[model samples]
Target chain A: MKDLVPERYALAFRLYPYARSPDQDATAPVRHKAIVVGGGPIGLATALDLGRRGVPVVLLDDHEGAGLGSRALCFAKRTLEICDRLGAAAPMLDKGVQWNLGKVFHDDRLLYEFNLLPEGGHAMPAFINLQQPWFEKFLHDAITAAQAEGAPIELRGRNRVDAVIPAADHVTLEVMTPDGPYRIEADWLIACDGARSPLRNMLGLGFDGRVFEDNFLIADVKMKADFPTERWFWFEPHFKSGDSALLHKQPDDIWRIDFQLGWNIDRAKELEPARIRARVDAMLGPDVDYELDWCSIYTFQCRRMAQFRHGRVLFAGDAAHQVSPFGARGANSGVQDADNLGWKLALVVQGIAPDSLLDSYDAERVHGADENILNSTRATDFITPKTPVSKMFRNAVLTLAETLPFARTIVNSGRLSVPCTYDRSALNGPDHPEMPARTRPGSPCPDAPVGQGWLLSHLGQGFILLTIGLDAPESVMAHGLTVPRLALEATPELAARYLGGAKGAVYLIRPDQHVAARWDHYDADAVAAATARAIGKE
Target chain B: MLITTPNLTRPDESYARLIATHEGLDEAGSHALNARLILILMNHIGDDAVLAEAMRLARETGTEAA
Candidate 1:
């Protein structure tokens, strides 16, 4: 307890340390193409996505690197896929503990076990349990490599944004560093400053949502034990540790344990090492020796801004929305927000796409935020049943889940994060009704083994004309933009995922690998119109 | 789904069994038993439309009788 330095400063690695930029010494405020505030997972990923697209972007953070503690442990398949696009998923998958099986328990009996990915042909697993620090570290490492390859990215540490002024076209910012305060401007401002977003507050925006009346003690413990890398959850645990408990294995030998420490607990007393160890002792028995790596008491709120985009400024990640940690939706959804916004912002900045394309970012990400909020809230309600009837129903569901397959579906031990399909998005183009719904308009392109590589690997960050069992021109010109064709023979996995009853389909995929439109065969006029609608030109 | 007329041929036997299930239970125990019974019955009546009708009828009849 004596060494109380923040985890960001105490990590084994030092990221972008505070350094004076040329903008700091300029005579007047320097205006940049894109300025991202906060160097968290969402911020860094956003900058990386934009930078890789040849957009000059700067990321400003108050800290040098990720703070201490294994904050977010579960990165879903969709998150890994997004990271794959950013050239960061390799290290994450290499270092992360991948698991698709999860076990749910009631009292001392096992209720049921479920596998997230039963039929798998995808490149990434169902989920990976990597500590948040490592997740951000991988993104930073990728940024470093991308910079070496001449991707226009500049990371500034210990630079806190003091103020932001938004006008019709650009945004003005006052940044404070260790040396002093300086003024800068950005054509577009992105706020990824986490849950308690100071930037959101500065802009006088309201992040309105419900806060559950409960507390959770998250303890990351390091031990030499042979626990399988699977997620184990308990309701009314037999050990009497708490109301509910969760155990997961991370990359290192460290295991994460979360105990639901009901509302109205002593903040200082509960944090005592002996008190926390008592709960751990009860769970692990007397023989297993373990050391507490880090622990914290967190009370979560399922919240989001009214709208993600406000004029010239955009909010992303926890700055735009927040959810309970039960479903691991927090960081996963944030990275998706970066994925959704990057291409649109890039096109808009390059003058290829109209400004209305950015509005779809607000429309689509707000949709994503709502979906995450709904799922996490439902999971929270089931975890902490407020009323006696709710508790009884929860127990009843658990009771029946032990033997009945139907009852098992009722049990909600966190729905877990899944990619959201913008079913009703304004940017969505025409959908082939005969095609599989999984790869319809507004859905993320399902990855399937293509040739030696994967389907998603070929949908390189641009408008793609993906043709299956058909021939198309090398590229089609649409609204002064080129849509290259990636031809492939219809494999069984691809047929099942992309082309259902339809024969020889042509798909118009957005830059973020989302299906915009599909047809039985290529028609240059139809593809061009769909491309126009996909980018909000319609 | 909510049979206004008698559907169970052995209605008395069924009522007797229901009463016997709560014989030795205290107030809270009886309440818990009733909850379990409701869930079991809900599972038996798998159709959501039928269950909704029964639920609505129960609410309507309870308010009228009270």
Candidate 2:
């Protein structure tokens, strides 16, 4: 037995130390008090988050081993920051290739490369590309460290969970381990299983959305090129076809190419490596040679769970939605799901906040998932160039875009984000203007250089007040906003950005970086009222 | 490579760019700042709405959504 602190935060499933435990009997399948099924990024992140918080959890996965496969190459900056908070970010930072710009090309000729990283206040480069295996190893190590520290994350790898049924207080799960059948009970269950999540199906949840007719062949190829490693896309990309290839560097020498085979090609035959290789060889030129590392045929799909939660059993990652990877939504969104749920779940499991606080998880992240689905679909539509009319239009747009600065900027910006906010939600109100001609409440916050640290570095794990003055500058702040969360008034150096030395602006910020509300002057009443709404006090 | 510049490390040119992203600047000030920001960020990486969103989200919500 280990100490209470370590016992509370151990990882659950999917990964186990290769070394035999100092205790010989560790191989026996011990019944867990809480269970999380599936060892995908979402599941593993959840398990690690739980263990770190001292929650006894059981993790199960059907995979033969850890994520050794090649998949999702571009890990977004936001995801890195989230992982940083989870304590796995440092290793990830070192392992992946930080990228700032990506170029688009057609027929080996230049089209446009979008530069993705520049700051408002982001901590890392916009995104990094690495083989999923390398990143997975980093996460696996983090989970093990958290577990060894005594929050034991018990793993039952090669274990397929046959069924999970939620009872009033706990979940009854039937799992088939390598050693055979066993029944386990846990106080709560979280199904982070992927798109084929049996757990969600067993619960009778509907996975609803459109499955794209387009088939794409994604191949990891060893090719030497003079191209920048940071470049990600190529418009009119296919050589045999009009233009439809997206190429990106994975690590350094390895590049990934996703070639659209169109709706007409047999999804099976078009994806066969031999078929794909024949096409790749043609595109690279008759004389050029490229070696293949791994290949897979993919179909872009837009889908989401009808419900994220039913009582105690919850869902995250691909279990909730499967967006196309175009905007790097699938993996990036999953990590965000883990970040959002991790803290709230810990608080709920520890009895810090009311369980209802957990409901906000669905409210916040589901909306984001919906937004991402829309963005990815748009990106898919823009780049697809499938229909003859659409292809012609896309070609015209791209050709004209090169000559026209405005069009190029628009296309470029579409790759980046527009300031989006959830200010429209019930949590966000109409007290201020619909979008203050300038400062919209609940808008995405940009990064600002502030004293001691960048203002953003100060925002992890709590609420913040961006008022014109100091932390206790206003007489009203001395009384505190009605919102129950912690509020740290920014310093005088940074205070000028919000409300300042003058009758300046004041903003009530939520932990997730959505502007709850803002005002030009310090009105104790308005500030308190806005704060109340922000923390759901109203 | 990613460093948070504390306030206006160089106040002469940066003051206008800083004002536009946070609060409203007057016509001349806003135009000048936007142009400078466009030039500044274009050289590094195109800084646009995503940057605006992160800033607004951080300032308004107090905690970073990222």
RMSD of each: 2.7, 14.3
Assign candidate 1 its CAPRI class: medium
The Cα error of candidate 2 at residue A380, in Å, is 1.7
What DockQ results do all the predictions give, each relative to the true complex? 0.53, 0.02
Candidate 1 lDDT over A1-538, as tens digits, reads 3322133446544689888999989999999999999888999999999999999999999888887778888999999999999999999999999898899999999999988864567899889999988999999999999999999999998888888889898999988887788999999999999998998999899999999999999988999988887899999999988899998998779999999999999978999999999999999899999999999999999999998999889999999999999888999999999999999999999999998888899889889989889999999999999899899888878888898888888799898888989898887778887889889899999999987888899875799999999999999999979999998989999899888998889999998999988999889999999999988899
Question: Which residue runs does candidate 1 get wrong by more than 4 Å?
Answer: A1-12, B1-16, B48-66
Give per-residue CA lDDT, model 1, range B1-66, as digits (tens). 656787898989999999999998998788777877888888888888888999999999999999
Best by DockQ: 1
Model 2 lDDT tens row, B1-66: 223456556776677656547576676555545544444454354455666665565577765453
**How closely does chain A match the true chain A in each prediction, as TM-score?**
0.98, 0.80
lDDT of 2 at A188: 73
Strongest candidate by TM-score? 1
